[model samples]
Target: MPDALADALYELIVATRILANEKVLDAFGHVSVRHPLDPQRYFIPRHRAPELAEISDLVELTLDSEPVRPTDFRLYSEKVIHGEIYKARPDVHAVCHHHAHAVLPYAISGQEIVPVFHLGAVMGKVQFWDQRDEFGDTNMLVVKPEEGASLARALGPHWTVLMRRHGATVAGTSLRELTFRTVFTCDNARLQSQAMAHGRVDALSPGEVKLTAAHQLRPPSTNRAWDYWVRQVEKAGLMPARAAAKGASTTAARAKKADAKRAPTKSARKNSVKSKRRR
Candidate 1:
């Protein structure tokens, strides 16, 4: 593979694992990057868990979500989510779709996920799109081009859009930026929920959102966070092979593994006993 494509794939894999490690994506979500040399095509993983994604699992697809070449690999049913957004927004170089638990409450409750902190200001304006609005509710998947296009319209000129009762899709100018926005946006949602429990949410003002996002979303900040997340994935033993060899420590990975095997917490033990008693 060419250097550019290889690098893109490597970073894409890292972004996938980082999102999974951060709990922004579980088994169902996906992330994609536009082809480095081709505006007409983009790349996403074959149908599989996001955390398990590797370079070899990537498939190149057109803006219409068709495979560039015939393959037996199963594609994501919602691949059109990336393609249609790419087609609609030339400025968006990366796209991520996730149903993170933190964001789901807002998505299902029809509440807007506004910026509650400086980092979340990166989510400029969030839009909402209900599947029932146009498609009248089928299987709730954006499998069809028309449905994807409708979603693209709803996401018009925005950084993120929530799918009613589904998930949220985030667009960014680059892969790092997309990862940053997606992860922090979910964090913002969680913080918003906590604040709401206390009575009211003091969201950032428009001027504050604009100024802080401009300052915080720059390359230096994004790269700093990206480096930290890459190390985190490395520690979790999920970094891509090429990048993994340089910085990953077998000792640290083993230590983390050992921690996972430690006995359950007191709260967990209490919950288990309570469940048994009820049974």
Candidate 2:
């Protein structure tokens, strides 16, 4: 069996890259996973762009959001978003925060994001969390515990919440679930807006949400979605460049080994020595 923490770190990196490839995250967003063995802590990447996040960039943090060890890489200012949600929701094992452009209009206009299609059923009952309501006026970032806690409260019992004029937070029971929710939420928003323009909008009814939720959101389906996006990301060459280099080196080494094995042995040398002795 793989180490739980190591697996979480790999998934975290892949999720970050997937979000970036899907355009759900630009340079600003982040994703995290609650440590599989240690529920009291979670793992988030240092303050790097989601596309640039690597396994080495991850930092282990307590539920309170402090690093388990000192890090030279700067921590994310909005990590409170992940930590506080983990602290508040024991059932949630993964979190994603993104400034998706398609959903920003809803954040500003006080509109609820609804599932216009099947993939979006995970967005169950989206709520809005406006920082101004409590803080009155600041940078509008969830940099403090109280602010993060307020956001968590806004997300109560829901899988998604819109942060007024900032972005959105998505939670799930696993990394694949969180990735699915984040990507589909953005896709649903774009599709919903386009659908609204054509005619009367029709979102999934509660019954529809209940019926289709499990089929689209669980293991085999979730794994397929994650795998597809990861392949796309890899195809686009968004992963670490060193990976390609390492692959090339490994292939070259294998080729060299094969050539050595196929080459003729130096049996002629012994024959020449025997011939010289005869001379």
Best by lDDT: 1
Report the Cα lDDT for residue 275, model 2: 10
Off by over 4 Å in 1: 243-279
Name the lDDT value of residue 273 in candidate 1.
17
Model 1 agreement with the true structure over 1-279: per-residue lDDT tens digits: 335655676678889999999999997899999977668778888888999987777776778777655557778888888999999999999999999999999889999888998999998899999989898958888888798899999999998999999999999999999999998998899999999999988999999999999998999999999999989998998878854432223322332353366343333233321111000
Cα lDDT of model 2 by residue, 1-279, tens digit:
544555566677778888888999897988999978668778887787888877666666677777654446678888888989999999999999988999999998888888999988877888999999999997878888898899999999999999999889999999999998888888899999899889888999999998888788879999999889989988998865566334434433443353355323233222222111000
> How does candidate 1 score on lDDT?
0.83
lDDT score of model 2?
A: 0.80
TM-score of each: 0.86, 0.85
The window of 10 residues in a row where model 1 has the poorest summed lDDT is 270-279
TM-score of 2: 0.85
The candidate maximizing TM-score is 1
